[model samples]
Target: MAHFEKAKSIHDWLDQRLAIDKVNKVMQTEYWIPKNINFLWAMGMVLVITFMMLLVSGIFLLMYYQPNIATAFDSVNYTIMREVEFGWLWRHVHAVAASVVFLIIYIHMFTGIYYGSYKKGREMIWISGMLLFVAFSAEAFSGYMLPWGQMSYWAGMVITNLFSLGSLEMNGIVEWIRGDYVPAQAFLTRFFMLHVLLVPLAIMALIGIHFAALRIPHVNNQDGDEFDYDEESAKYLAGDTKGSKVIRFANDFLSKDLFVVAVYLIFFFYLVFWNYGFAMDPVNFDPADGLKTPAHIYPEWYFLWSYEILRPFSKDIGLMAFGFAQVIFVLLPFLDRSPNVAPANRRGPFAIWFWLMIVDLIALTAMGKLPPEGIFSTIGLYAAVTFIALWVALPFITMMEKKK
Candidate 1:
C-alpha cells in the first residue's frame, strides 16, 4: 500500500505540473492561427524532423570515418564496404535524407512565397529561412568532403577555387578548414568536425529561433486572415487547430507535423533500401594527383548551374560574366516584382517573365552536364542567348505591359 501510494503521488504530481489545457488556452486565445492551413503547412515540421535524422545518423558516421587523405577513402570502404555493422545503411539514409530535406525546404520556401507568407508581420520568419538556407548549404558542402572519394576531392578543389578570386586565397581557406597544409589529414578531420558538430549545433539553434518566431507571430493561412471565433464555421476552425496540435506540450501548429514526419521517414527508408547508395568511384579513391585530370569533372547536381555558366566563357569572361550571372540568380526574390504573389494571375507580360526564369534554370542545368566542346558549345550558346532573352527582355516586357 505504501509503494502504490508513492507511485500515485508521483504520477499526480507530474500530471498537475503539465496541465495541457492551460497551454492550449493560451495559444488559442493569444496566437493568430489561420483556420485554413492544410498539409502544405506541415512541411516546416517535416524539415525539423529530417534535420534530427541527419544529426543522429551523422554522429555514427563520424565514429567510423578516417579523415586523413592516406586512409580517408580506405576508412569509408572499411566501414560501409567491410567493417562497421549497418554503417552503409546509416550512410545512405543520411545522403538520401539530405537530398529530400533540400527538396522539402525549396517547396516550403516557394509555398510561403506563393501565399505571401513573407509579407506584413512575417518578414523576420522569411529572413530567418533564407539564413537557414545558407547555413544548410555550408553544412552540406562540409559534409560532402567526408567520404574523401574522387568526386569529393575534385568537387572540393573546384568549389574552393572560386574564392581564389578577389584576394580570397583558396589554399588558405582550404588549409584553415582542413587544419593542415593540404586536403590531407587535417582537412578531413576539420571538415568532419564541422559536418558532425559545429554546423549542426548552429542549425539547431537557428531552427529553435525560426520556430519560435513563427509561433509568436502566428502561422499564416492561405486566406491571410485570423480565424473567426463566433460563426458555426468558426467552431470547425477551433477543432482543426486543436486537432492539429493535440500532442502533449506541442503548440497548435505541430499536430499535423508528426504525420508529415512519418511520411518522410517512410519515403527515406524506401530510398535507402531500394538504392544501395551512391558509390565513390575507384578512380577517385586515389588522392587527387595534379598531373592527371579526370576525363570529365562534374559537380554534384546542386551546383550544376554555376558550373554550366562557367563552361562557355573564356577565362576573363568566365570570371566576371558568369560570376555576375550567378549573383543575379541568387537575388531572384528581389528581382521579380509581380504584385500578384501567386504564379497564376501575374497578368500578361509578368507571366511570361516568370516562365522565362524557370526555363533559364532548366537550360542552365542541361548545359552544365555537357562538355565544353563540339555540340555542347552550341547548346551553351543557346542557353546564353535564352538567359539574355529572359533576364533582359522579360523585365522590359513587364515594364511595357505595365505602361499599356
Candidate 2:
C-alpha cells in the first residue's frame, strides 16, 4: 500500500504539470489503429527499432572513431576492430543495421504505395516519410565517408562531381561543397558533423512530423475500408472492443507491433552475427587512395536505382532524369488521380504499372552494380526510360480508374 501510494503521488505530481492523461490519450491509449491492417502495418515499428539499434551501435563506434583523413581508416580497421573489446561486434551491428534499414524503408515505402496510402488527405504522411528517407540517405552517405576507404573516397568524389553542371561548369559549387577540389580533410570534417549531428536531428524531426501526420487520417487499412474513427474508438473505450473495428494504440496495437519487431530482430541479428560481410564492402577494406580508383565505384545498393537512371543518358539528360526521379516520389499524391484507396491489385492497370515499376527498379539496381557497357548498358537505358514513362503514365491510367 505504501509503494502504491508513492507511485500514485509521483504520477499525480507529473500529471498536474504535464497533463499526462491527456497526452497519453492523444498519443497512445486512446489513439486508434484499424483492426484490418496486416503484419505489413508493423513496418513502421520495425524501422524505429532498427534506427534505435543504429543509434546505440553508432554511439559505441563514435567513441573510437577518428574523423581525420589520415587516421580514420586505421581508427576503424586497426584500433577499433582489433584493440577495443567487442568493437568488431559493434561495427558489424552498425554496418548491418545501416544496410538493412534501407531495405526496410523500401518495403515500408512500397507498402504505402501499394495500399494507396498517399492518396487524398494523407499527402503529408508520405511527404514526411520521403523527407525521412532523404535524411537517412544523407546520414548514410556522410557516415560512409567516415571510414575513409577506397570506395568511400571515390564515391564521394564521384557524387560531389555531379554538382559540376555539364557545360554550365559549376565547378565552384562542387569545390565549395567538398571544401576543396577533392574530398580532403574539410570534406571529411563536414560530413562527420552531418552524419553525427545534423542529419540525425533532421531525421528525428521528420519522424515526429510523420507520426503527427498519421494521427489525423489514422492508418489506412489493407482493404481501404473507411470508418468513423471517433465512433469506433468510443466503442473500444466503452468495453465494446471486440465489436469495434479499431484498437487502441497503447497495449493492443503495440502488442502486435512488438511481435513483428521480435521476428525482425531475429532476422536482423542473424545478419549482424553471421552474414554482415554483405554490408561491408571489400573495396572499403583498403585505405583511401586517390591515385587508384576501384574497378567499379558505386553508391550503396539503396542508391543504385537512381544512380542507374543518371548513368544511362548523356550528362545533361541524365542530370534532368535524376532530378525528376528524386522529386517525383514526393509528388505521388498529385500524380495519382485515382479516387479508390484500395490496394494496387484491385486497381486494374495500376496493378500492372506497380509491378512493372518494381521490376524496372530491380533491373536498374542490378544493372547499376555492373559496368555501364554493352548488354548491361542497354538494359539499364531501357529500364531508366521505362521508369520515367511509368510516372508519366500514372495520372492518365489512374484518372481512368473507376471510382469504388
Candidate 3:
C-alpha cells in the first residue's frame, strides 16, 4: 500500500500540470470491463485490428491507384501489384482483410443476439454496431468498383440499378444516386469519393459512438447476468473508487484479446499470402468492358444471403426484401424479448431456431453463388421463406422460454 501511494502521488503530481491522468482515465486504462466475457467478446478487438490493417494498406494503395474509367484496373493489377514496393502484399492484405473483417463482425453480431447483449441498457451500442455494419457494406461496395475489373463493372451495374426496382419514379432516384443512367465514369468518381472519404468518416464517427455507448453499460458476460461481476470486482476497488463491477481494461481483457488477435492474424495472413483467392472471383482479373457481362455475376459472400432473397421476387418486392435484409439486425433488439440471456439457458425453441437460421443463411449463401437457372431458384425460395419466418417469430418464441 505504501509503494502504491508513492506511485499515485507521482501520478497526482503529474496530473496537477499535464492532465495526462485525466486523458488516460477516458482513453486508456481507467475504463471498466467485465472480466468474465469469453472468447466471443474478442470479436470486436479482431474487427479493430482488421480495420487498422485495411486503412493502412488502403492508404498505401491509394498512393498509386487511379480511380478513373480508363486506367483503374491496370493501376491496381499492374502498377500497384507489379511496380510498387510491397504493393502486392498490401493489396492482398486489404482484399483478404476486408472479408475477414466482415466475418468477425457477423460473429460479433450473432454473439450479441444469442446472449441478449442488446436487451436493456446496451440497445444504443447494438444499434451503433449495426449502423457500422451498414456503413461497412456500403464502403466495401464502393471499393469493389475501384478495381474496375469485369466483375467490378457488372457488380456496380447490378447494385446501382437495383435501386430502380420499385417503379418509374425510382429510376429518378437511381439516376440521382448514379449521377448517370448507367455505371459510368460519374458513378465511379462518386463511389471513389465515398470509399476514400465519406464512408470512412462515417465509420469513424459510428465507432466513436459505439465505444461511448459501451462506457455506461458493463460488458455482457456468458452468464446473462449483466451485474454478475459486482461482488467479485468490489474487492479490487481501493477505498471509494469502488463503484463499477469491472476489471482493468488494459490487462484483464487486453492480454486475452491480444492473443486472439494474434491467432486471427496468422490465419488471415495465411489466406493473403498462400490462399490468396479466398472470396475473390477470377473474372475480376479482366478489365471492365461495358459491352461484356460474365456468364454468372455473383456478389461477394457477405452479401450472398440477401442476394439469394432477391432472386425469386418481382422488382418491387425484391427491393423491399433487400432493404429489409440489410436492416434486419437493427430490429433484433426488439425481436428477441426473452428475459433470459445465456445461450445455454436461453428460452425454448429460440436456440434451435437461431441455429437453423444460421444454417439457412449458409444454404442461401451457397444458392447465391450457384447459377440461378435450375435448382437454385427453388432452394432460394424455401430458404428465403424460412429466414423471414424465423425473424418474425423470434420475439414470441423466446418470450415463452423458462427464465433463469
lDDT of each: 0.65, 0.93, 0.84
Ten contiguous residues minimizing lDDT sum, candidate 1: 243-252
Backbone Cα, N, C clashes tallied per candidate: 4, 0, 0
Worst-scoring 10-residue span by lDDT in model 2 = 1-10
* lDDT (tens digit, per residue) of candidate 2 on 1-404: 22323345878877766789899997888888999999999999999999999999999999999999999999999999999999999999999999999999999999999999997789999999999999999999999999999999999999998889776889999999999989999999999999999999999999999999998888999999999988998898899989999998989899999999999989998998989887999999999999998998988999999999999999999999999998999999999999899999999999999999999999999999999989999999999999999999999999999999
lDDT order of candidates, top first: 2, 3, 1
Residue lDDT tens for model 3, 250-351: 776788899999999899988998897865679999999889888999899999999998876777777777777878879887887776667633556877
CA shift of 349, model 1, Å? 4.3
Candidate 1 lDDT by residue in tens digits, 133-171: 767878988877877776677677666666556344456
List all candidate RMSDs to the true structure: 5.7, 2.9, 4.3
Q: RMSD in Å for candidate 2, one decimal?
A: 2.9
Which prediction has more favorable lDDT, 1 or 2?
2
Candidate 3 off by > 4 Å: 1-14, 26-28, 228-232, 238-246
Better of 1 and 2 by TM-score: 2
- After superposition, the stretches of candidate 1 with alpha carbons farther than 4 Å from their true spots are 1-33, 166-182, 223-256, 276-291, 316-350, 381-404
Q: Ranking by TM-score, best first?
A: 2, 3, 1
The total number of steric clashes, by the backbone 3 Å criterion, in model 2 comes to 0
lDDT of 3: 0.84
